[model samples]
Every structure is written in structure tokens, then in C-alpha cells.
Target: MIVFFHHLTLATTTTNPSYLTPSTARCNSTAVTSCTTTTSIIARCQSYEVSWNNHCYYLDGLGGNCTTGYSLATNAVLGCIATQFASKTYRSTISNNCCVWTADTYECYGFNNNCNTAGPFSAGPVWSGAGCLSVQQRYSAQLTFCGSN
Candidate 1:
């Protein structure tokens, strides 16, 4: 038999933009599990954490089927992360933007501006070139909410 363990440590410090406010900081820890057998395997992955001001957020996994779109998956993962990290909140104030992949065009598109301010319904860009021709490619965009400046 084989055993596997995973641990994640998140740490952050905030710098006050003005003299009237004081700096703040925090740190968090969580464990993820993965196991494998000769016939099958189970794994759990975590998205790269995003931090703004003093808050941190991450998607636990894809969370749902991406074939429809990322909105559902994004919302579900954010909710789960919020519940796990009680002290921090998902950046709901942030705009809902996703890097969508078009199978036919074989391109990955991002928001025109900051991911947070981009409108929710924007379809994004379409580009075609050498690296953009792979229909088997995959990409993802992650959004998180935090305190404003």
C-alpha cells in the first residue's frame, strides 16, 4: 500500500496606503489528500491563490463541468473556499470574467482590462496563429475578491 499527504500554507501581510491606517497580516494552513492504487487513483488539486489587500482566495478544483461555461464552476469553487477559510471571503465584489476557450478557433481569450472590472458577459477576443491551432489545448482564468484600495 502507498500513502500520500499534501499541505498548503498561505501567508500574507498588508501595507497601509496612508498614515491613518495600520498594516495588518495573517496566515492560514490547510491539508489536501491524494491516494493511488494499481487500478485507480484519486486526487485533489488547488488553484493558485490570489491575494489583494489582506484577503486571500482560491478555487479548490475545476468544481464543475467547463463544457457549459466557467460561471458555474467559478461560483461553486469560490463558495467552497469561502466556507473552508472562514476568516477570509471570496471576492464577490470583483467582476466575473473568465478566460474562455473556443474549440473551433483554438484560442484562449482574456479580458481587455483588469480581470475584476471586466463585464460579466463579454465574449473576449479570438486569435489565430501557430500556437493557437490546437483544439486539444486547455486554459483557465481565476477570479478572486478582496478589499479595495
Candidate 2:
């Protein structure tokens, strides 16, 4: 099932017309043509968003321009975020499409059980351009201990 959020466009670029449009229908990870088409329409992040502490944030500028106290967000960071997200929420492995976005953007991911039909879906909205490839930490781990005599 697909869900549509309130549609609003802060800005649009000729490079990508799908900006802020209904994107839940794009990037069907199960279909190669669908995913390719989606990717082609959307542009990469101009600001290059990065996943930090399970949250997505855009860098100050392009070409790895990071501010003080902030380092570049690499694939490793995104992968770590994906791994953490998967383990905490579903306690399962991540899909191959996990952390697929190569730019700063918003991302929508599905649970491991339904990554195909659903997805860690991207190729949609770019952060500074056109796409929906962002992440937020919705779960946390708590440890419980038992004492034995």
C-alpha cells in the first residue's frame, strides 16, 4: 500500500520535475525499470545531505564542504544508520537497497520483511534538488538485566 503526504514545493529545478510531487508511487524497488526511471528523473543532492545520529542533515555546500564540528557523511555513515534502523525496528537484516541514495535527500524505507514491495525507497526527492531520501531514528535500544542469587 502507498501513502501520500501533503504535497508542497519549496522549489523546483528543470533538472528534476518530480520535486516534491507525489513520490510514493516511484522507486518500486521490486522493478528495475521503475527504479531506473525514478532515479533518472530526480537529481542528486546539491548540499549533499548526510545521516548523523539517525537524522538527515544537509552540508553547508557542495564538494564535501563541511562546517566545523561536522565531518563528511560517507556511505559508511549511511550504512551504519541503515543497519541500526533495521536491527532496532525489525530486528532483521537490511535489504540490498538500504542506503541507496548517493546524495543528500529524504529516504523512505520498508521493513526487512517487505523491502521489495515496500522499500528503503529512494530515487525520489533530493535534499537540495529533487528527491525524498532522508532518515530519522524512530527506535532505540534499552537493556534489561536480571540478578540471580
Candidate 3:
């Protein structure tokens, strides 16, 4: 199992209102093709993968120019992980903090203050695909975040 531990610099103006909130879903995957049965299960597995990939992308500052900065964050993180580990299992431990600017136009970044705050958090280990012959390997992905108190 591969492991990654680091802090993400996520800062934006108040007008942007960016929060370091975790994804609602614990696990996500992509759609599976060429499957005749157990489509639902396959879909779930795919969703988990997709969810984790997106999370990685956003954290790496590749989420693109979105109002909430979600898109950029997801893309960056995903791209970084994929580039390094083409085909390998890895776990990530993320340090979560809410940083925001004082004004909409001005940039003043800080964490866990009146201007910035934290949100609900959750983390778990992700198992490789199940019931899908295409992905019959034992891999695990664990993600944890340090919430701002």
C-alpha cells in the first residue's frame, strides 16, 4: 500500500468562499463497460475510483477556475497521483484547513478564523474493485483529513 501525507494550500477570497470540505461520498468509482450483469455493483466500484481520483486532482491545484475552487483542486490532485503512480495502490493523508481572503477582491489567507472555518470530515480505506473480473487485485486507498477546530 502506498501512502501520501501532506498539507494542501487551499486559499481564496471571501467572494469565492472556498471551504476545505470533504466529498460527501466515502467512495466513488467510474462506469464499467462490457459487463452484462451486476451493473449496480460495478457502477459503485467505478464511482469510488472516480471520487478518489477527483479528490486527488483538486488537492494538486489542477481543479481549474471554478467559483468554489472544487474543479481545480480535484483535477490537480488526480493528475499528480496518476502521473507518479500509473498503476499502483496508494493511500493519502490530507491536512484540511479553511483559508479565505478578507475581501472579495483582496487576498488575505488564514485558517480556522472568523474569515475561515472548517466543516464535517470523514475518511476510510478503499478496496479495489469487487465482482469485476477486470479489476481483481487487492489494493487499498485510505484518505484522512485534519479538521480545523
Query: Highest lDDT: which candidate?
Result: 2
Better by lDDT, candidate 3 or 1: 1
Candidate 2 residue lDDT tens string, 42-103: 22322223233323433111222333433333322333243323312211222233223322
C-alpha lDDT of residue 30 in model 3: 52
Off by over 4 Å in 1: 1-64, 67-99, 116-149
lDDT of 3 at 73: 29
lDDT values for all models: 0.27, 0.28, 0.22
Give candidate 2 misplaced runs (Cα > 4 Å).
1-51, 57-73, 87-99, 104-113, 119-149
- How close to the true structure is residue 91 of candidate 1, measured as C-alpha lDDT? 29
Range of the 10 consecutive residues with the lowest summed lDDT in candidate 3:
139-148
Candidate 2 lDDT trough over 10 residues, lowest sum? 140-149
User: For model 1, how does the per-residue alpha-carbon lDDT over 46-130 read when each residue is reduced to its tens digit?
Assistant: 2333332233333221212222212221221222232233222222333233332321222222234333342232322222212
Cα TM-score of candidate 1: 0.19
TM values, all candidates: 0.19, 0.20, 0.17
lDDT string for model 3 (1-149, tens) is 99999989988764511232222322223521121221233212221133332232211111112223223222112222222222222122222222211112211222222111122222211122112112211112112111111
